[model samples]
Target: MTLDFSVVTGAWQSLLLGTVGTLFLAFSGMALAMIIGVLGVVILRMQLRLPSLLVNAFIEIVRNTPFLVQIFFLFFALPLAGIRLNPTLTAILALGVNGGAYAIEIIRGGVESVPKGQTEAGLALGLHKHEVFRLIVLKPALRAIYPSLSSQFILLTLTTAICTSISAYELTSVGQRIEAETFRSFEVYFTLTGIYLVISLVTMWLLAAIGRRAFSYPQR
Candidate 1:
């Protein structure tokens, strides 16, 4: 069969909007994940028995479960408790929770890698406990884990395509609609693969730039 990419030409606007939607979901989710990751680490470090255990439990539960099942549970189950989030919100929340679980472990490893002497030095300098963590530990720990964290974020970006399964307005959902209308599955999916590659590459470039700027320091 002859390939005809022209079938998707008429849907360019829809595709563009979908791309924007995907980016929005990915970045927003990423922000939430970072918040959760950092806070989880702090809670774990606090060494409080109950809170630490709860944080560990959350991390374990999320990491052990399938993301699709988690998303479905949020979308379909929460309403039973009178907490109904729309599809877009559900997708973002699901992505954040899933990504956060992994982020906690990744970040915790970095935090643990930090020298205990650094924390003690910060305290000797009369810094508050929170300030010490922030100034002495958090920055270096983040730098150590930035590569792994960025990779996870890139994966999170691709995972946005799965949000289409929940009727979220993203590139994959738009492509599926176009494919249904034009009956050109190969061409549609082929274009989508190309677009996703472009997105991932662009994301990598941005992450690299951010890392350089944020973590720039004289090398030992």
Candidate 2:
């Protein structure tokens, strides 16, 4: 089909609105994931076997399963078990929890890569475990793995499209609505594809800047 300017204009409008929803879902999910990731990494660093095993198991399960299935389970199945959440809230919770699991593994790897000698030296200097981890381990781990963490966050942004399945009205869902209205599937979706690409690029750039600023000392 020939590219229709009218269709492009209308679809682009809808896509812009959908982008708001997309941003909300993606950023909120990442925020929650950050909390989960930090906690998981700290627990793993406790060197407790059971905590390590539990965290690892959660990571594997979330990473291995399809995100769509996880979303569906949280949205549909939980209500049957006496817990109910609105669609948007359920979508965010599901995505956040799943993304958090991946973040845990990534952050845990960074924590593990910290030098044993560094911990020993801190202890010899009479530092507490928490003090050592906060001052020495956390910064180094963040610096070493910031690139990986940023990539995961980017992936999480794209994963927001899964929210469409639950009618979350994110960017992809907006494109779907436009396609249905105008029957210009190609124009509708390709426009959205470009929008998503731009959003992802800008997000990664911002994340790189933040990582550099926050982790500057570690680089030195």
Highest lDDT scorer? 1
Each model's backbone clash number: 0, 0
Tens digits of per-residue lDDT, candidate 1, 89-125, equal 9999999999999999999999999999999999999
How many backbone collisions does model 1 have?
0
Give the alpha carbon lDDT tens digit for every residue of 1-220 in model 2: 5787578685566667888889998888888998889998887867799998998888888888999999998889889999988877887888789889988888888888999999999999999999999888888998998999899888988999989898886888888887888888888777888888999999999999998798887444
lDDT of 1: 0.94
For residue 73, what is the lDDT in candidate 1? 88
**What residue runs in model 2 are displaced by over 4 Å at the alpha carbon?**
11-13, 218-220
CA lDDT, every prediction? 0.94, 0.86
Model 1 ranges off by over 4 Å: 218-220
Give residue 184's lDDT in candidate 1 (0 to 100): 100
Q: How accurate locally is residue 128 in candidate 1, as Cα lDDT from 0 to 100? A: 99
Quote the lDDT for 73 in model 2.
Answer: 84
